[model samples]
Structure formats: structure tokens, C-alpha cells
Target: MKYIVTALICFIILVLISSCRNDFGFTSSTGSLKFSQDTIYLDTVFSTIGSSTRTFKVYNRSNDDIVIPRVALAQGTNSKYRISVDGVPGQVFENVELLAKDSMFVFVETTVDIMDFTGDTEFLYEDTIEFDSGANLQKVALVTLIKDAVFLFPERDAEGIEETILLGTEEDGVRISGFFLDDNELIFTNEKPYVIYGFAGVPPNKTLAINPGARIHFHSQSGIIVARDGTLKVNGALSTTEELENEVIFEGDRLEPLYDDVAGQWAAIWLTAGSINHEINYATIKNASVGIIMDSFNNASNGATLKINNSKVFNSSNTALLGTTASIEATNSIFHNSGQSAVVARLGGDYNFNNCTISNYWNGSFRQDPTLLISNAIPNTEFTADLTAANFTNCIIYGDRNLELALLDDGTSTFNFKFENSLLRFNDSSNSFDGIPAYDFSNINLYNQCILNVDPLFEEVAAFKLRIDNTGGANGIGDPASVTATDISGTTRSTSTVSGEGPDAGSFESSDLSGS
Candidate 1:
């Protein structure tokens, strides 16, 4: 009987021990807590912009529920990074419980000021997420490259209110205002990159000259506006020795490779009405909502509203060149990868292109518009304007879409255009263009001296190299008199043995073939 009583006492002690284990929390002393990743890498974040939230799962692999004594950043509250544990935001957390066979989430985010750190144009930040009493630690490798730029923003008053100004005329005024540069700030040199926060306007009768090798970066929805009677002259020239240097660059402020082709990061270079004598030479403008917006204000006495030569405008979210009842002449230029038309002349405008390549192969999104569009009316609006003239000579207009050219005439105004000695991509399998009188290719006067649906044989489409190959059908099809002497890259156009002495039909001349 005594032996049986001792056994019973041992059983009671065992039951008590099990109950105590269930009642008390287990400390994370065994280092058995596992994480989804040992290190969370936050890639290339812009200065002053919060990064996308990243998540890491903390799993309790052991048999018992473990309570983390402390979960905090190594730098405590002084760190730039921020973390949230189970939806609770804090730099330091204690008594975080993880049930057995369960997992909890930790979300991380950060916004670092570039000027606050020191290094190259890009700065790197590091911190650790420690668990318990610094016994178990998981590192979050934070690295960012801060790009220094000339910030151009509107002045704020004592109450932090931005100033305003009138954008348009009294008749059709756009009461929009932003930072306006004075005479001293009108020049943009190559010393440093310029970052515009809002619409940077050039005062009336003033000229904003951008020197060669100047890099202009724009923030979201930011751009440069040439006010009425103002001139924007981009004096970018090709270096005699350098292949791709000395050209002025206009793009979004993000320098990461991931944002290289991201469109709509900023607005356009707006050329308001009465703004004349504007020129862009050897400039690279890309990744905007609209590349160049030439408003409907024509100086019949002055030259075209703007003249672009040996330049490139591509990867725009909307139209690359939107000329609304405005005059524009572009030569030896390239326009491509637009969400809408590469070149859109709406409500009448005098537009001309010579030896220019306008291609739209935008696969980024669902593109409903063609590459080249000419309309005498605005859709869904009661407004209708005349299309004065649109002439393309020695040019190549092609894209992945079936119809790369759309000419919509409202039948009220004059709609006139001509394609001479050019390669145009238009598929009439469904009679979309042939049935419409505005796009009737059968009319020799409208579509005269042009090649239809023929490949231009671009060297590389993905690289944005629209140069025609030596054996391309476009090579030597252009008229020598109509084509430019040199291509956009200053290379001499190729001479074809079949078509006699003439250059290719695009902006770029193929270096694979020799010309005599």
C-alpha cells in the first residue's frame, strides 16, 4: 500500500509540471524562432519618398508558444526605417507572442533624406532588427542612392501657401501657377542636374536656354512651360568625338534602371500660345505624360512654333508630340513608344517631318491609338478645328498596330496630308483605312510615293535603335534631295545600288553599308 501511494504522488507531480508549462509563457531562449528571410533587401528608393512596404514572417518552430522579450531596431528610434509588428507600428516592441505552429508578420518601410547622409550621389543605410536581448538578430539591408538635383519649387509664404499666376490668356485662360524662373535662373548648364517640383514657367518675352550636356529631371507631374512670347532654346549639340555624349537629357528624377522605361512620371514641355522661335536640337526627351505640347497659337509671321532637329522623343504615356492647331517642323528625329500616338496633330495644325522615324511598339499597356494621328476635331467634344497641313517626306511611320496612321476629318474643315517617299505600316484587312475617305490610301494625292506594310528592319527594337539594316527595304528608297545629308547621329545615309544614290527612309543611317 505504501508503494502504491508513492507512485500516485509521482503521477500528481508530473500532472502539475504539465499544467505549469501550459500556464506560463515560453521564453525565446532556445533560438528556435525562424524567419522567412534572414535579410530583407530594399532596393533603390528615392529620397523623401516612402518605400513599398515589405513583409517578413516570423515562425515559431518549437512545440511551445514563445514570447519574444524584445523586438526592436538596433538603432532604436533614431533609425530611418520604420517597422510594424502585427499591425502595431513602433520602433521597439516587447512581449511579442508567437503561438506554436503559427507565424506572425512584420512590415517594414523607410524614407531617407539624401542630403542627411554623406557619400557619393547615392547613399547606403544599414540597420538590424534584433529579437530578445540581442541574442537573435535579423538584418534588414537597406541601401539607397541619393541623387542630388537642383530643386525648383514655388515659393511659400509664412502660412506655407504657394503663389499663383495666370497661365493662359483672358479669352481661354488657365489660372495655373507654379515656380517661375527669373532672368538669372533661365539658363540650365551642365554643372548639375535640375529637378523641377512643379511647372517651371518662363516669363513672357524671356528665353530659357538649356546648354549642352544639361540633365533636366522632373518630379511627378512636373514640367517646363514656355509662357506666351517666351522661347525655349535647347542648345544641345553632338560632340565631334563622343558617340553618345553632350546631348541634353530630359527625364524623370528616378535614376534606377527599373524606371528607365516608366512613362508618365512627369508632364510635358508645354509651348504655350504666342510662344515662338522655340528649338530643340540633339536633345533626348522621354518618359513624360506628353513630350512636347504645342498649343493652338500660331504666329503666321514668325516661323513655326517649334523646330526640332536631330532629337529623340520617346516613351511618353500619352502622345509624344501633341500639336493642337500649332505649327511644328521636325527633321532627323525619332519618336516612338507612346501610349497614344507618337505624333498627334489635332484640330488642325501645320506639321512637317523630314527624314524622321516615328515608330510605336509600346507593349507596356493596352494601346488603342495609332502611331500617327491627324484629326480636325476633338473626340467627345463639340469643338472642331481645321487641320491646315501635315506633310511627311523621306520618313518611316511603322508600329505593331494594324493601322499606324489615323486621319479623322470632321468634314467641316480642311484636312490635308501627304506621305512622300516614306514607309507606312497600315493593314487594311478589315477595310478600316480604305473604307474611310480621310484614310483612303487609293488616292494617290493623299498617299503618294510611299511604301505600305513593309518592314523597316530595325537593328534593335528593344534598345530603341531604329536604325535600318543594310539589307532593309527602307535603305536607299528615300529621295536624295528630300533626305537630310546626315542622319540623326551625324552618320551619312547609305546609297542603294538598286535605287541609285539616295539615303534610307528613316532618321538613322545604317553603318553596315558603305556609300560612294
Candidate 2:
């Protein structure tokens, strides 16, 4: 009777184990501590100086209890920040404890003294925690910055920007590198699309605005760039001639894959600077190496505050929208896959992307980002930085099931990144052709309440035509409430807006001629 019972138990155990997938199966438990955040950001300048706070999480995966000996910044020799835990380092826990499979959180606060701030720029020091080898403890880079001056515009004030016209027209694809402006505004208006191989210069305080219907294209050999402390205000209108000129003429009896005669072609707009406030509204920005790149070095900080509302971004080899300013508040926008990223942020890029649909491979291929962001490196004379602070709300990110998704790289600047409530779909849908697995996200600082593994059920996205499918199942983008009956920008629609069991999903809508 005992032998029979043992045999039966073996059969039952085997049956239970067979029910699980073999590929993703793991038989052992971890014996290491896992950290939630590896890199922290402290990105304040002289113009905005104060105290800042950040937190890190530590998880013990070992079977035994783990003890943390010392929790402090391992700043080598020279230290610029006065870091404290619970108001003072002396008050920090000497023996932090965590049980198996349990977690503990540590808070770090930093203050910057404005009086001692002599340079316009400041460097974020890397802090480390030491622990015993056998014991498990995760490290969190809790970063904060107190800035009294704007590093992007250290020497220049709001009164020193002037427009410059270099030889009226230079060679095609020739770069107009490093132009400076102060106090006055700069304009780049041409009759037709002009290839700027280089850049149009502007200073920190100048407000630069581009008019509607202006077609600015980049050259293959050259790209346009903006330095730190410059402001760009681009205004485009639906009724503008430029809109009609660059309008996407959809082709279909039903719906077909989006067709771009030029694939991975040169991008149209590229801007990267430190602290400038960028406002790009109602424009069609597409086809380039990079859509817009706002670096955290030399010039700018409003990539956090880089507001891109009522715009369309499509087709590039690299990131479509990238920033690390203050925030990126974009409503009613369309972002198509360029290369590795549709949007990327690091070193203090705070973004608010609402009412948008980001899809890859709608033009017969999925969007993919080739670059990936890793960890921190010192920014003194060695490494270049791209730290960020980010926010994403009420948006649709559809991957054609492509292999590539997104990545955040090392920023020579500061670091803070956050992604809020949004919808993320299978961007890796086109498996055999150009699908790579979703890009590694360890480089991103913090992501909160974002939806993933979704099915938007686009009406044959390969054909580049989209309609809300009616008879088909509901296309879920993490949350439906993200876009109530209206949007953050207050755009409204009705169920009648949908046809053949089709309803629009993103923030923008094409005109309905059916009147159905």
C-alpha cells in the first residue's frame, strides 16, 4: 500500500509541473538583493537653487535576513552636496534589516547652497552603498538637486540674442555651426524646403519662433542643432498651406500600410540645448535622423518643459522626440517610429505626453531604437550626459511587435525620468522582418502606472490607415479612462465617430465625410 501511494504521488506531481511553459521555467530561488533604482538625478542650476528629495528601494531575495551596515554617499574626496538621511547622516540607520523576500526603502535628501554656487553648471556626484558579499542588499541612487542659477545660460541674460544670416544661402547640406543671439529674435523662413546641414544659432534668453508653411528639411551630410539656453516657439495651423503641402495623402480602398517613398530618410527638425522652453504646436515633423534632440549640456533645460502640442512626428532612424528640459507636455500629437525611440528622456527630462498615438511599422515596418541607456558615469571631463525627468499620460504606444522598443542612455547632464498612466501595445508585432525584443528599460529612471501587453486592434496598420474597429473587440490601451469623452486639451467625440465597429483611439481624428 505504501509503494502504490508513492507512485501515485509522483504521477500527480509530474502532471502539475507539465502544465507550465518550459521556456520561461525557473527552478531556483535568487540569493541576491534587487534594487529598484540604480541611478538618481540631482539637476538643479544656479537660477533655481533649493533642497531636493529622492527615494530608493531595496529587496532581499535571500532566504536569510540581511543587514545593511552603512547607507551613505561614497563621494570620492571632494564633495559638493550635503546629503543626509532623515535630516542628518548621523540619524541614519546603522543596521538596516530586511527579511527574506521582503523590501526596505531609503530616502535621501540633498540641499544646495546658492551662495557657494559660483559656476553656472554643477555636477551630480555618484553615491554608493557598501555591503557584505553574502548578505543581500540593493542600492538605490536617490538623487536630488538644488540650483540657484540656470546652467544652460550661465553668462548670458535675457537681453542678449540677435539673429544672424550667414551668407544669405550657403552650400546645400552645409552646416551653419554655432551661431549666437542675444536680446533679439531669430527667424528661418524660406520659400521652399531648405536643407540646413548645420544650425541656426540662438542664445539662452532669446525667443525664436518659426512661421507656418515654412518647410525646413535637413541635408544628409549635415544636421541642424541648437545650443543650450535657447528658446524655440514653432506655430503651425491646420489651415496653413504648409499643412496641406506636407499632408499625408492616405491611399486605400480599404486600408493599406502607410507608404513613405523615403524610408529612414533624413529627418526634418533637430533641436538640442539645455534650459530653453520649447513650444511646438500644430506642426507636421517627420523624416529625419532624429526628430528633436534636447541635450542636457551646453545650452538647455525645458525638455522637461518642452511642450509639443498638436503635432505629428513620423519616420526617423533614431529617437523621434528626446528631451531633458523641465517637462514635455504634448497633447493631440502623433509619433511614428523612427529608429530605437519615439520619445526619450534623461538627466531631468520631465515629460507630459497626453492625447497621442505612437505606432511603429504602420508604414510597413515597426519603429525601433538602436541605442540603450545604461548607468551613471562622472560628467567632469570624461563622459557626456543625457539625464532626464519624464511624465507620460493619456497616450497610445503601439509596437507592430517589433523587436526594438526604447532605451535611455547616459546623460552628461542631470537625471530624473517618470512615466505616468498611459497605454502601451505590442510594438514588436512585425517579428520576422524588423522585430527586436522590447528595448532594455533598466536605463529609464522611474516608470509609474503605465500599461503594457495591450491590443489596440488597428485596422490593418500595415496599410497605414486607421479606424476604430466596431465589430471587432474593444482595443484596450491600458486604461480607457485616460481619455474620457474628452481629452486633456478638451477635444470631444461621439460613438458615431466610430463606424463598422470602428472608433478612433488616439487624441486626433481625421474629418468624417460619411456623416454616419
Candidate 3:
């Protein structure tokens, strides 16, 4: 009796498996398919480069299972756009099935050459994705903007080896790949956009000047390196309108809007040891491993110099402004949204920030470092140097973390730092950080009339709008004499409707608070 019962159960399981596999009663779709969107805008794409993959859903709302007789691009195989229906990628598909009340996704991407079009430098590329043929057909539009750009990359030799220069070797004997920029590439103009691949090194004694309205895009792992004795000058003027017409912008080559806030898309602007006389104004640098690295080889006696004004650097995987034994003076600048600290002064440095905003609201991962970190000693190393001067005046140093400022001294070097009339975010909830000597908020010499642990009430964090409202603690409490006359947006800082009636701390003076 037991053997008979077990055989019967096996037969029932087989029948259930066969029933599940037999989905043969599918009816032809009668143009009743619904889509997630009627059109998909692929954003801007550089010539000869592919676009980011975009997906949309096709829903089968009917009760009966449906079979799409045909699904294809309107231009067929000749179309520059590519589509993948269900799990199959091709110009067309036949007999695609969708269960009742189910949905399937269609992925689309494109790579078009600008030369294929007419005389225009930028043109619109458009096509349609067809769901079915004839009277029962449904269509979805596809659009992309293609722009012509100047591409700079290393050439390959006869032996198949690409051109490369030496960026110092590692302790493990591995050398970093780089290439020097050509003489003709010294001056980047606004006539066209520039795209760089690999590390482009500036030759010694030469200067790379970028003019106003210039857009520089870097491919993955690519960046610019200023060699010893080299200089980089970004001469961008304030824009007359909101379009930032005169600002020099540096970002990754991915033109998709989805990558706008993504960090670490490329490398950094490396001002190597001995590089000097660097200046950046009215610039925007974003989405890099490290936005800018100012290194003087840890030689306190020979520090690199960078005078930056009216600039913004953010979305860095590492620190936005990384200074190692360098001298940096910044005015009306903004640094925010970094994976680690927004600003890091390590191994000692001479740094000064006036009317700047250093806020790190990094949600990409668990951030272990503070928004502003200053240390005279390298971690787990014997290297130590003197902190000549680290000063912050009329600035906002705040973040999502409890302690946005950290000062570490090995006690072997001069840790000279001061903050005046600024707003800081330091909340030692557990009294863990209050015990440290650097947390002595009552010290008049180091902390002078600085607001602590108050919400700045930013307009929007994700949109990079650091402007504060009337309720912001940074409003009208800044020392007018120490800050810039005009804010980052060219707004005058002296006038305010807020009660305190002074310049507002940070790179921005809120128009809502400052009645201007």
C-alpha cells in the first residue's frame, strides 16, 4: 500500500509541472499595450560615444495572455539606436509573449556619429520603437542630442603600446601611466568641448590656460597633472545670466543626466610636487576621485601655492580639496558632498578659507571622516610636519555627521589653527569627542564667536543649492570685514534683512535673509 501511494504522488507532481509549462493559449495583442512612458529622452551624448541604457515597461492589462506578433525599431537594423526586448537583443523580435496582467521591460541605447548629420555641430537624433505591425501597432519615441567635441588621447606605437609618461612609481615598483599634453593643447578655448582620455600631464615651465565657457570632460581614470614648475590657470568670469556662460566646467565624459551627481567618475586635477602658481576662478569641478590634490611632496619649506576664488568643487569620492604641505587661499568657494571629507589638510599645510561652505552630506556610504579634517601627522606613519596656519573666517563647516570638524596633532609639530565668526556642526552626543583637546570650544584663541550645532537650513542638498533661509543659524552672523564683498553668485553680502545685520557665513548669502 505504501509503494502505491508514493507512485501516485510522483504522477501528480509530473502533471503539475507539465501544466505550468503549457502556456499555449496566447491571443494576439490588439494594440492594447500600455507603456511606462510615451517617449524616452536619452539626454546629450558626445559624438561616437554610446549612451546610458534606459529602460521602460510594457504592460499587458488584458485578462488573456498575449503574444506580440512583432517588436522592432522603426528604422530596423540600420537604426543607430539599439533595443533589447524581453531578454533578447536585436533589431526585431517575433512572437514575444506576455502573461495576463504582466509587464516586460525594453532597454534602449544609442551611439551616433555627428559627422553623419548636416553642417550643424550639434543635432537631434530621433527614432521610434515599434511594438507591433500594421493596424495593431504601438509606438514609443526615442530622442538624443548629439554634440561634436574635440577628443584628446594617447597614440599607440607600432608595438601596440600606447604612449605614456611617468607619474612617480609606487613602493611596490608599479608605475602610473600618463602622457604629456601637446604644445598645441596648452590653451583650451571655448570654441568646442574637450574630452580627455588617460592622464594628460602639463610640461614643466608651460602653462595650460582654459578660457571662459570651456567645458572639459574626462573619461574613466583620466585627469590632468601639473608637472613640477608647471601652472594651470582657469580664467572664467562671472556669468551675466543663470546659464553660467563664462564658467569653466570640469566633469566626466558621461553626459547622461543620471550620472550628474555620481562621484568618482574620473580621477583628479593633480598639482604635483613643485608645481606652482596655480589659480582657479569662477570654476566648477565635480565627480572625481579627488577634485584637486595640492601636494608639495610634504616639504614644508617648499609648499605649492593655489589661490582659488569664486569656485565650487563637489561630488568627490575622496576629499574635494586635499592639501599636503601646500599653501591654499580660497575665497567665495564651495566644497560639499564628498564620500569622505570635503576638505582634508594632512601632514600639515597653510590653508585659509574665507566665505566658503564645506558641507558633506554623503549618502553613498558610511562616512568615517569629518567634513573638515586637519592633522599634522600621517596616519600609521612617522611623517609629521608643522601646521603653519589653518584659518577659517565667515565660513560654514557642517555636515550630516555629529562632528564635522576634526583636528589631530601628534604633539610633535605646531598645530596652529583658528576659526572666527563661522558656523560649525559639532555635536558630541556621547561625550566621546568632547574629551579631545581639539574640542575645546571655550578656547578664545582657537574658537572665536563661532556658532555651534545649529541647523543651517539649506535650500536643497542634492541640487547643490547651499543657500540658507531666514531661520538658518549662519544668516547675518559673519564678520563682514573678513569675508568677500560679493558672494559666490555675485550677490553683495553687506545687506541683510535678518536681525544681526551683517554678512552671512558661507559662500552664499541667502537672498531671502539678505534682503538684496
lDDT of each: 0.83, 0.48, 0.89
Off by over 4 Å in 3: 1-32, 59-68, 95-103, 169-174, 297-304, 429-438, 495-499, 513-516
Error of 1 at 101 (Å): 7.0
Q: Estimate, for each residue in 109-176, the C-alpha lDDT of model 2 and write its tens digit.
A: 45555456445334443455533323443444534433332121113237864323242236643333
Score candidate 3 by TM-score against the native. Answer: 0.88
lDDT: the better of candidates 1 and 3: 3
The backbone clash count of each candidate, in order, is 4, 101, 1
Tens digits of per-residue lDDT for model 1 on 392-483?
99899999988898888888888888988888998878864446666667688887668889888887776677877767657677887678
Candidate 3, position 273, lDDT? 85
lDDT of 2 at 238: 51
Q: How accurate is candidate 3 locally (lDDT)?
A: 0.89
Best by lDDT: 3
Q: Against the true structure, what is each candidate's TM-score?
A: 0.82, 0.46, 0.88
Candidates ranked by lDDT:
3, 1, 2
* Deviation of model 3 at 427, angstroms: 2.9
**lDDT, model 2, position 34:** 77
Candidate 2: regions farther than 4 A off: 1-185, 188-197, 240-260, 264-268, 297-303, 324-326, 362-389, 402-421, 426-454, 459-491, 494-505, 509-516
Q: Select the stronger candidate by lDDT from 1 and 2.
A: 1
Candidate order by TM-score, decreasing, is 3, 1, 2
